[model samples]
Target chain A: MKSWIEKQKYIIDFTLSSLLRRKVKNIGLLILYALIVFILASVMFFTHAIKKEASLVLRESPEMIVQKVVAGRHDLMPLRYRDEILKIRGVQAVEGRLWGYYFDPVFGANYTLLVPPATTATEQAETEPMRTVVTENEHRHGPEEQAMPLVGAETIGAGNIVIGNGIARVRNAGKGEFILFRTHAGEGMPLRIKDTLSSASELVSSDLILMTEPDFRRFFGIPENYVTDLAVSVRNPEELSTIAAKITRLFPDSRPIIRDEILRTYDSIFNWRGGMMIVILSAAVLAFVIFAWDKASGLSAGERREIGILKAIGWETSDIIRMKFWEGAVISLTAFLAGVILAYIHVFFTHSLVFEPALKGWSTLYPQFKLMPFVSAEQLTTLFFLTVVPYTVSTIVPAWRAATIDPDAAMRHTGE
Target chain B: MIELFDVRKVFNTGKPSEYSALNGISLNISSNKVTVLTGPSGSGKTTLLSIIGCMSRPTAGRVKLSGREITSLPERFLTDIRRKTFGFIFQQHNLIKGITALENVMLPAYPLGERHGPLKERAMHLLDRLDLSRKAHSRIEWLSGGEAQRVGIVRALINDPSVIIADEPTSNLDTKLSYRFLEIVETFKKDGKTVLITSHDPLVYQASVVDEVVRLRDGRLEGEAP
Candidate 1:
């Protein structure tokens, strides 16, 4: 009792029991307060987790992409630019990429089509074949299907195609099924599906369609000398920017998109979306603050009498204020912790059903993936600021007013 | 001694409904004796007791305990003085509801921030001395009228102040209980504590423990208290 901590302990003890005395009213407030915290925390967790997942998927992408610009817009880059980019001092390797977007009139959705470079005879000769090896899961398969596991997606040949799980799902096509496509010349060309891409990388490859370089070039009417862009890899990661600067200097019409820049763009998008969601939810927070203020300001008759009794029995105004402060603290903190735990479960475990639309719109291929769990000190601090500070301040002002009255007058309300 | 010099108290002063409750009053009582203030309604007995009890300030006047003026002190210092020097038993007992009798008795010392363990022991001792040991854990609404009144008395003494002020302590009590209250006041007087009481009950002022009876009429003191 001689120390400040000892004093607050007794006050907090009284506050808890006093709150229980009015449990019906207090619990109502706790539920509403926790609900607000849950919303704010859930959005924060989902946004951060999605951004982290995006960066992780981007880690495997090219170090830098050099795209040709025509009148400030993206244009096809010629294979001749690959030779110049390869001459950069730090450039490890450079390859022309063939990728484009196709819109299906029937489905009214877009698909990403890509072409994997042909594996050279020397590279194929150096690799081990999977035809002789049988994995543990192969024992469960029938003998015929296990003779050779499905051809790897990267080694598929012409007249054959590998599609992503999302494309396979929406097209209702499976292995050995033929998907017909309309070429640039308005002619129908059907390619046999080899296999659907693995679900592990589904977050990025969900809407992907892969074909051989010859089929891609012939179907899209693209010239053999031109490709979509150039994928550049640098030997020294620190010199990636230097190589990119060299590429830009050699070709003034080139735009270099770095992996880190792409990652930053994803982070900024998620942060902006999460912040906007919170700003919209600020109305609810404001309503709760006003509700708390009203609850404190309009003290019931019994409550006023209790304050009077405390003061009349030698307790001071400061003591009453302290008691009220503890009451607010207990309520707000309990609500805050409960909300944060629930939000974590919702975002990571449940996949945040309410906010799943942000991942993909109604018409797009929705990636079926779980977000990694993320919790930070900044999020908790923001929650405390939004919920605890306002409610506690609202209560103290009214409690002080009730306490500052004369004990006798407060007790009887007669101004005696 | 507890002394008052030319005390004047006006409620809502300068307002349309302003009215004087105490007018130019002065009084003194010895350090270790029991004194009774008896008066009709609106006679200013409670006002005079409140002023001397240090629960409020006087509009104009001076009050002293052991020859020290406290009339003009700030509310904060007055509260400290009140907590250390006086205990009050109101007319209605004023025990906070929803709490046990033991908690109500311990309320006065909470501001002093006394350790709960020793404070609880002291409160139990007081309740036991008043024969309220069995009812210590009972809620306020569950206690009998006499038991609640004694609970108020124990709460008043928990701070162990030098002065005890009981306003209408016997107003809600039966004759037997009123006599019991007088017996408790007799013990307080024997313990060398100053006691002031405002009451309409004859059993209080007529008790053998009382050393003087001061009366009031129409906002003015009578019978040697002036």
Candidate 2:
């Protein structure tokens, strides 16, 4: 084993020297190879990060949300639906949720307004119950506590609202500042900015505004008994599907979006994007394979001569093939590592600029957040098999052909 | 000892372009002696050298290297014989471009899988003996033809094989360089190495170091020179 390793070390050293000697001839191919890996890896990294973010955020979502469907579109749900859902066998708790989209024509963006549920305030009481509850009740209950303001002696008023990072940036509004918006009655309502959500939550909470229930109703001119949706929490998660069916049978016009269904939808969305990229990348890969095949098939006369000289100098055909194998392995592995590192930096650090627009979709208020750096061992292995294996395998036939040629004839053949 | 009986070489067999390069030729090469084969361009001197050197298999023949029959051996065994028994010098220097002369000399030993330290020392010693120490680190493309040829010689001698097969070694050299190369061949002979060369040059054929001069015409041995 040690002797075999030593032999490989010598071959690898020779391969490195040979590759370095032919850097100019190979630099273009290396760049092309690395760029292809970079593009594919970036897409994969960004999608994986986004999927992770969605799953994290989905953990906080209600198990099921029951909405009223009117004329094939979502409409406001009656508050009585929450009472009816709470009576179901596996239903643990039900709460009416008030949320609506507020369009600011000046900024040309829509901001979501949500009223905090009462249970959310109780859950966040570790930071001073009265003040935290007052502030949380003033704005919709955002998931991150750092984004909630530290309330002192002052109590949250009905006219105050907490906004997301994107909304604050777009409106240029800071804490204690006032922003004016047109209500459904076309009346100008000035709301005080209470706090800004943290940038970490920007992916999910961007363009979001949290206000008290009374403030949300007044801004949207909604009646007191009507709510946007009914959030249902199940005591037995195993019976969630059963409870959802019961809710559907009880309320025929109600549409219940289960958390599992939402997760599946998110999965399918990312999969579809990934599938599209694979289709597009398959073409590029085919072209690259053809390029590689052509380059490998037509071994340069200089290379053939080199092989011929090695053969003449007592090197066996297996030795020459082994040398060529080292050459292919070195190039492909180097390119794969370079491309993956670049993609990691592009996605995690630089926020995937090349693929962000296509992946994040076309929206004026797109989230400005960094993706968490996460790569699986499976992903690296897959990339290795995809790029390195095929490339190394592709060179074998050419190397064998070059190695098997008559040394005397090969050294004399001058045609390029 | 190297011996061949009824050696025949045909190119492009079973095709319209098939032509026999050698026809039932037999020869004997004694060990530790300098022998020269002299022939015209199409007279199969190089082809005969290739067959004797184990670079190619003869179509019909029985070849023995040190009395071991090798004509019907598989390529793997032939390669082993080529590595351990014979060293080859081609007409062209055939030094791979884009690498230093020392690297070219070390190329043959690389496949032997020896320690690079000892290999480098041996290669350096050969280069030093040939007075090519200065040009050792120079690229083959930058080296003069004579210097490149010397590098090729160093590469062939790196393995220290018993048989040195030179196919028209002095064909590309001036008289001075040709004499310098023959002096090296003389050194090999003094070291008890068998040197087999094919040359059309009278300088090589008339040299006192040559033990015998075998002449060939139209694929047939014309007989030893007087």
Candidate 3:
């Protein structure tokens, strides 16, 4: 083992100097290689981190959601459906959630206006027998969908609103600024911005506005006895499907959305995007393979002679191959490390401004939020196999061919 | 002693370009002697040198070094024989271009897994012996032709091989450097090292240290003089 280490040490030393001999060419290859790695790694890190953020948002949601589907279209669910869902066996509590979108014509961005749940699950379950109803409008805001965290959500009063950073930034509004909302009755209802959501939850809260129940109902003109959907919290998580089935059966027009299905939907979107990025990256890798092949196959006469002399001076074919392995490894691994680090900084530190707009998929407002780094050994190994292995092989195979020839013939061949 | 019996090297056999670089020519090189193979171009001098130095395998022949037959050894063993038993000096002094003179000298020892400090000491010592110690850190391309050639010679000696092989050592050197190379060959002979040189240059064959001369033409031996 010591001997092997010693041998590799000297070969690497030689390989480093050999690489330095052609500085411009090798540096160019390194930059191109690193650029490919940077792009691929940035895409991967962003997808993984955003998925994790989405999952965290999902974790905060109720176990199941009961939405009223009328004529195959999502309609405002009646508050009576919440009482029915709460009566299912193993169902702990059910609360009707009111939420809708407010599109500002001036900004051309849709703001998700949600009424924070007034009470906790246990409180709601305890007070279910004495509760009233609500009339509301359904909107596309997946309550479990936005990577939104409502900090001090229920504290806002009827005339006060909590806006997201995106809303605040686009509307140029802040705490104490009044945002004029156009009511469904074509009347302007003024709501003061109590606070802006933290930048930490910017991923989903970018276009979110949290208002009190009375303000939400008054702004959207939702009558009493209706809501957007029913949020079902179950005592036993495994009974979520059972309660969801019971709710759907109790109200045949209602559709139940389980947390797992929501999670899977979110997971598949990111995974599909990740897979798509890999397919696109494969084309870059193919170009890299061709570049490596060009370098390997086009060994100059001087390079051939260098191998010949190395062989003539007691270097075996294995030694030359090992030396070339070091050569390729030094260049490629450096590029890989450089690329990954740059991508990490770009994705997590800089919010991946490059190409992230496309990745977010048609969102008018982009959240400026830092994603925690999501790296795995498996991903790095996949990357190593993708980039480093091919380079090492390309180097060693040609070196082996040169080293196997008779030294005299190798030297004389270069004589021409 | 190095012995070659009826050695033959046929290139491109079974093809239209089938050619024989070495015909069944037998020769023996006594230990501690400088033997020169003198011939015109295409006279099989380098091929025979390559075969005798274990740089290649002869298609047909028995090659024995110090009474051990090695003609049929596998390539792995042949490489060991090449590394341990023989040191070759190429005609063009093919030191790798980017590395220093000392680094080029240390090339052979690198693959041997030798202790680097001692190996470097020995390499530098050999360069000193050739009056190249001052230029040991100069890149191969930066060195004068003769200095680069001397570095090549020290590279051959780095592994402390018993037999030294040189193919047209003085072909690309001026008369002064040619004489200096011959002097280095004489030093090897006096130290009990077998030296096999392939050269047609009169300065190389007519050197005072040469013990024997073998002339070749058309891949066959023409004459031998002692």
Candidate 4:
């Protein structure tokens, strides 16, 4: 085993020197190879980071959200449905949620306004029910659980709002400042900014506004007994499907968006994005494969002559093939590593400029947050087999052809 | 001892370009002697040398090295015989470019899986004997023609094989370098190595160290030179 390793070491050293000798020729291929890897890896890293971010943010979300549907469109839900939902078995709690999108023509962006359950000073002990809801749903061990700030009646008083970091950045508003938006009555409704959401939750909370229930209802002109949706929590998670079915049967014109379904949707979205990227990149990959094949098949005169000389000097066919394999392995592995590192830096550190717009989709207010770096061993392995194996195999036919020829004839061919 | 019996090599057989390079040639190469084969460009001298060196296989007939027939051996065994038994010096001096003289000399030993320290030591010793130690670190392109050829000679002798097969060893050398090359061949002969050379140059054909001079014409051995 040691002797075999020593032989490989010698071959690798020789291969390195050989590659360095032809830097001008190999560098072009290396750059192209690394660029392709960088592009694909950046896409993978970006999608993986987005998926991770979604999972973290969604961890604390309600298990199910029941929305009333009218003529295939979501409509405001009546507060009486909460009582019906509460009576169902396995239904732990059902809270009426007041949330609606408010369009600010000034910034030409839409911000989500959410009115959490009332929290007043008179009921201090039980005042912050929404804060309890968020804390209860928080992940046992996650950065979001620690990073998110707890809100109460004092933090968000009537007619005041806690704005997301992205919204604050766009409106140039700070704590104790006022953000003016048009109400349903076409009148200006100015809400005082009480606090800003943490940057860590910016991926999901971007362009969000958290306010009191009365303020939200008054601003949107919603009826007193109406809410945007009903957030449902289940006592027994395994019976969630049965509860959802019961709720659906009770209200035929309603849709229950389960947490697991939302997660599956996110997964499918990312997978679809990845699939589209593969389709688009397929042409480039094909071009690259053809380029590799052409480069390998058309061995230059000097290269052929070199192989001939090696054989003439008593090197076996296997030796020549092994040398060629080392050469290909060295080049491909270098390109793969370089590309992956650059992609990691690009996606996690510098916000994947080329791929961010495509992956993030079109949004008026883009999140100003860095993606968490997440790469799996399977991804690295896939890239290795995809790039290195094909390249090394492409070299085999040409190397074998050169190695098996009569050394004298090959040396004299001139390969012009 | 090297012996060939009814060796025949045909090129492009059954094609319009079919041509026989060697025709029923049989000969013996004695051990520890400098034998020269002199012929014109198309007289099959190089082809015969290639077959004898195991660089190629004869289309027909048997070739035996030390009375062991190797004509029908597989390529793997043939490669082993080539590595362990013969050292080749081509007419072009076929030194791989972009490598140092020392590296070129050590190329043949790489496949042998020899340890680098000893391989380098052996190459340096051979280079020193050829007065090329100074140029050992220089790339092949930087060396003079004679220096490169001397490097090639050192490379061939690096393995210390018993047989040295040189094709037109003096073709690229001037009169002074030609004698220098022959002197190296004479040194190999003195070391009891069997040396076979093909050349039309009378300088090599008439060298004092040459034990026998065979002549060939039209792919047939004419006879030993008088």
Candidate 5:
């Protein structure tokens, strides 16, 4: 008799060839497995990439933000809170972040508004115009009309306020126009547009207007001493907690939010997505288990006899078991690879359109971004164990039965 | 060498209609000879063959093969005995229809733990001996009845088992092919290997090459005649 390893190789080789002989049947199984894998990989890849991007953004955000709470609702922080919080140790820089909400009647989304200082020449010109912010439908307004065209933070400058590009395209305003803009309080303010912002941000970039904090207060009828939130930068990263604690003690009305806490809120969305994927994938896996069980259990007497004959010819029960296991391995590995590739194309290349409908429910549109869906060795290893190992286990019972069959009874079995 | 003593095989144990398939039969088969076991349907010819082939064990008997008492052994150990010592040809061709004739022949040799290099060569050699080298790659579904039977013979002989058991190996073959198959069995016998076959055809009973014919009537041997 041969060594066990040698015997297993022969069995696996024969099993592979036998499967090749029934390509039609095996390929059908492969495709079915692939569909399950594809869906799973797609959802996993999209959610993973989104979380990765969000985390990257959060890591680069300010160390902490201070907001005022009024009966659990975030309200405008009084201007005096900044001076009091700044007295806390570990505070390096304190700046006001003017945040508000506005409704873009054209596109339906809870649009957050913010005011950041004009950091560039283009923005200096944009703030000069306190007119209507026209995003699209340019012909609806005269060319002389001053309009605030929403743009991105990167394009803000002195005397300029950039509204979101969505607002520009929707309102159809260009450079050097007077546009009427409304404050959160429904007060209309006239301003001359300097330039249109080129891009947007996930939080407020797409449908927001950025101006100097002082200008924002004047436009919204808020006091010079008022700010929606205060962004605090720590002199030492290690001092964040001490600074937060100090601010909490000094200013009871103001709450300091650490960067990680904000990131956690973002992180929870991914955890939810992950939980959903598990539930959905587990259902698919159950279906696959049933399909595989039915297929294995349904082997005819002739098939069982074939197994017996193979064993009688010197093949071990382990060999027969391995043969079936390889059949499963081939199917699952191929499906896994194919599915991952499709998911890659969907995430990185196609922007995950197919998945958006399922994931983005109630949102005006899915977030605009591309995902890398990086190939992590950990993920692949985990996926391999998830797919191939269970399938191999599933084949064991059937293979054992077939291998242990009575050779004489097996020899007598016919198709009939 | 093979021996059977007081072999009793009962089907559907401990039931109202329980009946013995093989009842307290005893026999011995010498190595390097041809033994033909024949009987009517339900006479336990197949049951006896099954025990001799190591496919099943006698419920209340002792069976010895190669001087080892195999009846008491676990089926796991008997598996190797069946693999290395017994080659079986059934009433049906029993070739896997999806595979080629050569693959079918190589099926039995798989347990020998030979590498592909040797298994393929051995399979090819056996196929050639059976005058099936040209049809080695032919699918079982495409093979003629004679060709398929020859494939079955190749499969049985590929592992070079010491004992060859044929259960109506000619049932599916025509007269010419049946005679040809018998001639092949005779050749195996001449090679000093043991051959046990069951057949209803008179050709087997009257064959000049047969060493002995053990006639069974309804599960009891009439006589072990020369």
Candidate 6:
């Protein structure tokens, strides 16, 4: 083995130079390998980034929010509950929420306008800053829906409204422009677009519009004393159980929601999507394994003879195995890097083009999200395992066989 | 020394259509001698060579190299033995068409694990010795049959193996080229290496340097070797 290693420097040099001699074939293999790596890595990277972003937003979101049962229905909870709910010791703050939907009757495109709370009083203090705010709301696909989250405005301040980029694009309206929305009551009310919310909520953003609480209620003909839901903030997040128990007992009509609950729901969705990604990734991995197996198994007699001759000439089986292992490594690593780079570019700059297809639901989305690329250690580890490990293992058996064959048989184009 | 003691090789064993290629062939090839296994098309001459080369295993019986019984060893172990002790020159030269002459000559010894500097020097030295120094970097597709054969000879000799096995060495060569190949084999014999040449050509039989000629008929020896 020591002697073999001493010889291997020569073998590796020769293998590299020799493979280079067959530039066309090697390049062809390289491109095919790169493509596979790119697709798998991109999907994995993008999904993880989306999942992380969704979880971040979901975690910071309000605890138990109450909305009307009907789709597109925003029933007002009387402002009187502000005091009624505030009296509950666990409930730190009770604020009214107003949500409105805007539709451009011409193109049938829609936007959701919302007015949510000011998480930091300073954040919403600058009335002239024109910042867009987003809050978690029930995203309805149709009549029958569970806990699909939709992005809504944080506060209904006044005439100031916020919309999404997609809504801005589809309606051809930007900040400082009037967006006309026909509410559920079928009234065409116009409000000046103040700020467009930049969100990572792909499914929710495209059709979302935001308005001040007063503007939303006024535009929707909602009573001044009523609101769609209550945003309940607890004094102690860890004391959620005690606080939630107090709120539920005090106000049986309203539900006590913890931020974790909303986060968990979104996490489940992200998990489901992640699970699906795993399924697709597994399929890709299977394809890679099968392709590698078939390719190795289908080695022509001529190629096998080449391996034999290599062995006959004093090349060790281990040397042959190493050469092939390097080949697989080179191909997979190249592909993985390219794929990850492309995905990063797509998420950060292109907003994940591939994800757009999956993000688009049946109904028109009001506003589209700006997905950011995130790289975590766990994700990198996963990507590495998924991409490199399988390819490495895939080449093992064939490499071993090629390595162990009698050099004489190899040289003579015969096998054991 | 290469010795085969009643080596038997079978193909597709236990199947309905099983066949045996080498049937108890026994022979002893001493060092520093040129031995030819001459026979008609399917007399198992190549099969015998393959077994002697440790390219395949015997179904029964034993074969040894320098007194080491190799027939029962695992394939990889046999492969190691072959790498260190055997050299093979195929009928077609079998040079990788895409690589240069020097590279093709260096192919066999590549897996032996030598460093780049020494490997290059050694490969160049062999190519030079084979009178192929000028065409060292030229691709095999551009080399003539005679040149390719010489390269093949260079490849076989690179590892300094104990035995040189050539299968139909001169089939693609003209008479002059054939003599040149013989001269190469003669040099190896002078170096005390055992040389096994498989060919049915009369010219090979007539070579004065050949120590023995074993002819085969139907996978069996025709008579006592002349």
What TM-score do all the candidates reach, one by one? 0.88, 0.92, 0.92, 0.94, 0.87, 0.82
- Model 3 Cα lDDT, one tens digit per residue, A277-353: 77867888788778868875567777888888888777888888887878888888999999999998998888888
Candidate that would win on DockQ: 3
Error of 5 at A112 (Å): 3.0
For residues A1-416, could you state the per-residue lDDT of candidate 5 as single tens digits?
35556777777777788778768767877787777777777777776666766666566567899999988889888767877777777786676767676665655654445665332223343655543333443421222332233344444444466555555555666667666666657777765566544332332244556665555666667776777788888889888988888887787777889998988887788768766767866878789768866765456555676786675555667677778778777776788899788878877788777767565334553334444356677666776676667766666777777676665556546321
B1-226: candidate 5 lDDT, tens digit per residue:
8898988888789999997777678888888888888777777788888888888878898998878899888767888888788887877877787788988888876666677788889889989998999999988999888988888888888778899888877667788887898789878988878999887677886687778888776566775331
The sequence of per-residue lDDT tens digits that candidate 3 reaches over residues B1-226 is 8888988889999999999988888888899899999888998888888888877888998999989999888888888989998988888887788878998889888887888888888988898999998999988889988888888899889889899988888988999989999989989988899999988899989989999999998788995321
State in Å the error of residue B105, model 4: 0.6
What tens-digit string does per-residue lDDT give for candidate 1 at A62-136?
889999999999999987898888887888777687889989888877898887543211243246363221112
Q: Rank order by DockQ, top first?
A: 3, 4, 5, 2, 6, 1
Number of colliding residue pairs in model 5: 50
After the best TM-score superposition of candidate 3, give how far the Cα of residue A57 lies from its true spot, in angstroms.
Answer: 1.4
The numbered model that scores best in lDDT is 4
lDDT of each: 0.81, 0.81, 0.81, 0.83, 0.71, 0.69
Query: What is each candidate's DockQ, to 2 decimals?
Result: 0.47, 0.51, 0.62, 0.53, 0.51, 0.47
A148-178: candidate 6 lDDT, tens digit per residue: 2332344434556666667767667777887
**True-vs-predicted CA distance for residue B222, candidate 2, Å:** 2.5
Better of 3 and 6 by lDDT: 3
Q: What DockQ would you assign to candidate 6?
A: 0.47
DockQ of 5: 0.51
Model 4, TM vs. native:
0.94
In the range B150-201, model 6's lDDT, one tens digit per residue, is 9888888878888998898888889999998888888888898889999989
* Model 1: colliding residue pairs: none
Could you tell me the TM-score of candidate 5?
A: 0.87
DockQ of 2: 0.51
Q: By lDDT, is 2 or 5 better? A: 2
